[model samples]
Target: MDEQQGRARRPGGRSARVRAAVHQAVTELVRERGYGNFAVGDIAARAGVADTSLYRRWGNLQALLSDVLLTRLNAQSPMPDTGSLAGDLRTHAANVAREVTGPDGLALVRLTLALSGEGQQGLQARDELLADRTRQLQAMLDRARGRGEDPPDVLEVLDHLLAPIYMRVLFGAGPLTPDYLDGLVDRLLA
Candidate 1:
């Protein structure tokens, strides 16, 4: 067996086992120790991997954590298409809410925000994350246009529907409920 397979066999060959362990260790370290306070050696020790292995795979803590955020958390949230703007948007908002309020999502947002304070590179990564979602939403808007149901400025409508959910998540000030999502859809469709 290869090294990754050997590691996986210990826990029923789940690929996530090792990745999850590493992600958890890095997340906890960042929360308890702060980003700048830890090094690659420290992360490797916490993750129970050799420093060389960690470096060879992820290159840096930021990239590793970003992978964890994207793969484990964000990737699990389903984006729905419901044949109408209101239906689709409500579904999307609900999915976003579910992810943003979860423990992993909060940790990811915290890490991303902390990393973003470092300068251009961090900001670029943060933007890239958001850009991916924006592109997805834009595609949905395009689909709506092709069906002749979209407004003139579909992008703006999508932003208006989604921005509040993001604000609530970032500020930790409000719940993202189905009612709220429905209201957002109503406003956007109105």
Candidate 2:
């Protein structure tokens, strides 16, 4: 197994086992069949859990899928500390692009968009995830400021870099090539 795959998911317990199984099943199914297909029964059968168990714990497939995304995206990654802010941003951009464009990751994004709903009240789970991402992005900018770099507005950075990249990922407007990644990092830091 790869390093990430080798890492333990959860300690033993009936509930933990069920969640782990469900997470594994979701990742597999999403990989095989993009976000729009796949039903709760399929997940339940693959997870070795009853439909009631899934419904009781997660309420619905969208919630379960969001939970899976939260589990993956909330993982603690070391902040880029490459001395110069530019280098750090490049590192961060590369990491973000990889995670955003990876097969499973893209599938999660697609799923989240489909189920994210219209307003704040509708996309509560997705809002929670956005908050988490906002905090993480703030931390990265804060680190740059701590090192004496006059970082630009965090929201501007998000608007310029993050949103466009996500658009590309979701819309397939262009390739996430090395040049594109480097250009984004350079333009943002400029």
Candidate 3:
């Protein structure tokens, strides 16, 4: 290929821009209209792309939503690997708190919840999302075990740590104070 063709094929080109725009549009629409209110055409208009592009790339709205949620989840919460499990748990908890409370946080959470009820496609996406998160948690727990630390099971961590944070966010309980987060980690570890 010529240099011009190679440059045209470079990473982070029009394809990346289109994907980013579409993801942002989905996030905004979910925040504004909630899930299931908008269709792929709406997303295309908002993202300045053709509806066919979205359909061709993602197959359907559920697939696109799944991609957006998964991308946001992966981008927002990276696993922490401090030497001690406590440190890792604390960091992970804090990262979750921040994401759930961030500008697009509520929308993503609502999208996840909504996806679970949409039908077979939604159900599959929801299951995939849950599995992805479970895998992340299990990896951290495995690391703790490898270091000779006794760690709780993945469900325990989800139930005791993440569930509470999500509940607070959903219910508008209060700010996720550092003390409260640390307390959750400490209690789980105890």
Candidate 4:
């Protein structure tokens, strides 16, 4: 219901600010402590929201884990589809470089990989995220193939395309600059 029409609604207005805050709190806490030892009370306090609301919405940490991680990796970002393989790869590399180098992105990714072995649900979420990314990348390659480019070995290209970015993000091997992204694309394409 639209509040401007004077209809009744929840207290946080239409932007769902409380919901986002709670989810962010969850993400931060998970990044810090994984999913095992934290209490709902602590989470609620951290979020500055009611514990009841958190429980009512998330039920448990793993469910919220699935929602936030999968959303960030799969749905929150758009895949590059610039109609040419080189252009698409450059765009993809740049976007990923931006995301992985950011504070929240690095923490979330580190937490996801670090915590995946703790539970089946998290493992499944990680698996789904990987599959989603693979499908998106494959679509880009398939588009190039349709445009009369050589039939690409998608997996081989994926390694060549993503490894340097991951190494830079995870190990601080290099800066995630446009030069780095362009270099990766050039080397892969060459």
- Weakest 10 consecutive residues, lDDT, candidate 2? 1-10
**Comparing candidate 2 with candidate 3, which one achieves the higher TM-score?**
3
Instruction: Tell me the deviation in Å of residue 46 in model 1.
Output: 1.9
lDDT of prediction 3: 0.86
- The TM-score measured for candidate 1 stands at 0.72
Q: Write the per-residue lDDT of candidate 3 for residues 1-190, one digit (tens) a residue.
A: 2453354336689877787799889888987888989999999999999999888777778878877887778878888988889999999999999998988767556777788778888888778777877898899999999999999999999899999999999999999999999999999989
Off by over 4 Å in 2: 1-10, 36-41, 74-84, 117-122
Which pairs of residues have clashing backbones in candidate 4?
none
* C-alpha lDDT values of all predictions: 0.68, 0.74, 0.86, 0.69
lDDT for position 162 in model 1: 56
Error of 1 at 13 (Å): 7.8
TM-scores, all models, native as reference: 0.72, 0.74, 0.86, 0.70
Q: Give the distance in Å from residue 140's predicted Cα in candidate 2 to where it truly belongs.
A: 1.6
Worst 10 residues of 1 by lDDT: 5-14
Q: What tens digits encode model 1's per-residue C-alpha lDDT throughout 129-184?
A: 65666667777777777788854364665467656777778887677778877888
RMSD of each: 4.8, 5.5, 4.6, 5.7
lDDT of 4 by residue, 101-157 (tens): 766657456656745865776676667556767788888888899998753476766
